[model samples]
Target: MTTFHDLRSRRRDLLDDLGELEDAFAEVTAALDEPSNDDEDARAEQRRHRAWLERQRAGLLVVLSETERALLEFGADGWDDP
Candidate 1:
């Protein structure tokens, strides 16, 4: 039974982490495919970051789902976007 503010804060943080992780993954891939690659550290780092991103994304999805459920319980109060 978390408040909307708490859920929103966590969701925002999680989304930001996912964005950073995605950037890291993309950077690693680009470097790995380059002809003059000098960084071998990114392979492992990419794997780790990708895993972390997946976990965070899943958790955030759950939090959003729960938030929607709570909102539903409060009754539909004209949610249609005008």
Candidate 2:
């Protein structure tokens, strides 16, 4: 029995999560750009981490899109008490 309130809450949470992930992604990209004395193994680990973050970001974006669509479909008049 999901309500409009629930959808809105989920959307807000997703947006926050996306923002944090974006910041982390930027930091990782900057780290990758800079010259470091890290060993091959360490660099590889960083690349892997970046890739994982990218995948997570993509998934979150998809969920966020879906949530937005649901909100639109529900409309403002569809508010149901949680």
Give each model's whole-structure lDDT: 0.61, 0.87
**Top lDDT prediction, candidate number:** 2
- Positional deviation of 73 in candidate 2, in angstroms? 1.0
Cα deviation of 25, candidate 2, in Å? 0.6
Which candidate has the highest TM-score of all?
Answer: 2
lDDT against true structure, model 2: 0.87
- Across residues 16-60, which tens digit of lDDT does each residue of candidate 2 receive? 999999999899889999999999899898899999999999999
Q: How many angstroms is residue 58 displaced in model 2 relative to the true structure, after the best TM-score fit?
A: 0.5
TM-score of each: 0.53, 0.88
**Model 2, runs deviating above 4 Å:** 76-82
Counting clashing residue pairs in each candidate, in order, gives 0, 0
What is the C-alpha local distance difference test score of candidate 1? 0.61
